[model samples]
Target chain A: MKTRVIVTLKSGVLDPQGKAVHHALTGLGFDGVNDVRIGKIVELDLADGTSEAQIDEMCRKLLANTVIENYRIEQA
Target chain B: MKSAVIVFPGSNCDRDLAVAFRDVTGKDAAMVWHGESTLPDGIDVIGIPGGFSYGDYLRSGAMAARSPVMRAVAEAAARGVAVIGVCNGFQVLTEAGMLPGALMRNATLNFVCRDVDLTVANSQTMFTSQYADGQSIRIPVAHHDGNFSADEATLDRLEGEGRVAFRYAGNVNGAARNIAGIVNDAGNVLGLMPHPERMTSDAHGGTDGRRIFEGLFSALA
Candidate 1:
């Protein structure tokens, strides 16, 4: 089985890199961009019988820092 | 005081921290590898120095927080051992849940490396006892991810309890409330982005950082 985890900064948190990219876009003459927030996607290849609870544990333990970020896990 | 400095794979400031510990405590600080499952017996202080641990992979100090030695550090902290996490060490403490808040990229999107003025917020803790309350001092900080953030309620609690140990005199890294360093509720653990070890001697252009080590040694003694 394979799992994908999307980690994103929580709302109200500052994303400096995302802001920098947004600025560059504006400088390049792009318009109508309200905001931008950057995040990361982590793909994991797990063995059979991996439980959702285990994946959630992984997210809580290492994949995401609950203090400033949130993570979603998807299995396929 | 018996002290130990945790050395991760990419830790470059472990020696500097050890020297600071030795100079203040008059004892040879042990160098414990991150792979160790346990620290040396009867340690009074544990120093987590600055460096690009694990090359800051995944996240700054994220991988190191999960290393074998951090488990031991957490246990020691629970036993009332003094733990000081500086720079990357601060990131590890937050990641290990030993401290609250997360350090994000600087708002300037640039790596900041210079001496900055800091005010001693609370001098009652074991870590800041050497400095007078509201005293201004200069410390050097070198990091790209030193911006500290925490929820409003948590920040309020930290402030209410006087857990904030140091606050920047000027906004250096966009940290919330200008927090330069903080202590845990138990007052045994401290996490800060500035490198006190680098400022330990006058030869380094300042000796303001030496007070922290001196304070810890006297408290532990």
Candidate 2:
């Protein structure tokens, strides 16, 4: 089984890199862009019988900084 | 006071921090490797020096924060041991959840490296008691990710509790409310981007940073 963890900065937290990327996009003449926020994606390959709770625990422990970021787990 | 300086693989300021600790505490500071799971017994102060720890990979200080040594540092911090994190150390602290706020890239998207003016925001902290309130001093900061940000309510509460220990006299980084340094809720942990250790001696161009360690000892006494 493979799992993907998507980590993103929580709303209202300042995202300077995201802002920089947004500025770059605007400079490139991309329109209809409302806002841009940067986040991380971690893909994991787990053995059979890996529980969702275990994946959530991993995300909670290290994949996401709970103080400033949130994480969601997807299995495929 | 006995001290220890955590040395990550890429830590460049570990020796400088150890020298500062020794000069102020009158005892040699142990250089503890980041791979170590336990620190030497009865350490009083722990210095997490600045550097491109883990090569600034996966986010600055992110990988280092999850290292084995940080666990010991966090436990020591909880036990009332004084912990000071500088530059990359500050990033590690925030990543480790030992301090509030995140250090983002500089708002100007530049790596700032110079002696900048700072105002003593709260002299009550063990880290700042040596300086008088509102006094100005200069310290060198070299970092790309030093911009500090927190939510409004947390910022308000930090201000309300007098935990905002230092503020930039000028806009060196785009830190909220000009915050340069802050203390943890228990007041035992401090994380700041400026290199106070580098400015601790007059021979180093200024002794303004000496008082911080002096204040720490005095507060402990």
The best candidate by TM-score is 1
Runs in model 1 with CA error above 4 Å?
A: none
DockQ of 1: 0.93
The C-alpha stretches of model 2 lying farther than 4 A from their native spots are: none
- lDDT score for candidate 1 against the true structure: 0.94
Model 1 lDDT tens row, B81-142: 99999999999999999999999999898999999999999999998999999999999999
lDDT of 2 by residue, A1-76 (tens): 9999999989977777888999899999998789999999999999999999999998887778776788998886
Q: What are the iRMS values of all candidates? A: 0.6, 1.8
Each candidate's TM vs. the true structure?
0.98, 0.94
DockQ of each: 0.93, 0.52
If you score just chain A, what TM-score does every candidate get? 0.95, 0.96
Clashes of 2: 0
TM-score of chain B of each: 0.99, 0.98
lDDT of 1 by residue, A1-76 (tens): 9999999999899998999899999999999888999999999999999999999999999999999999999886
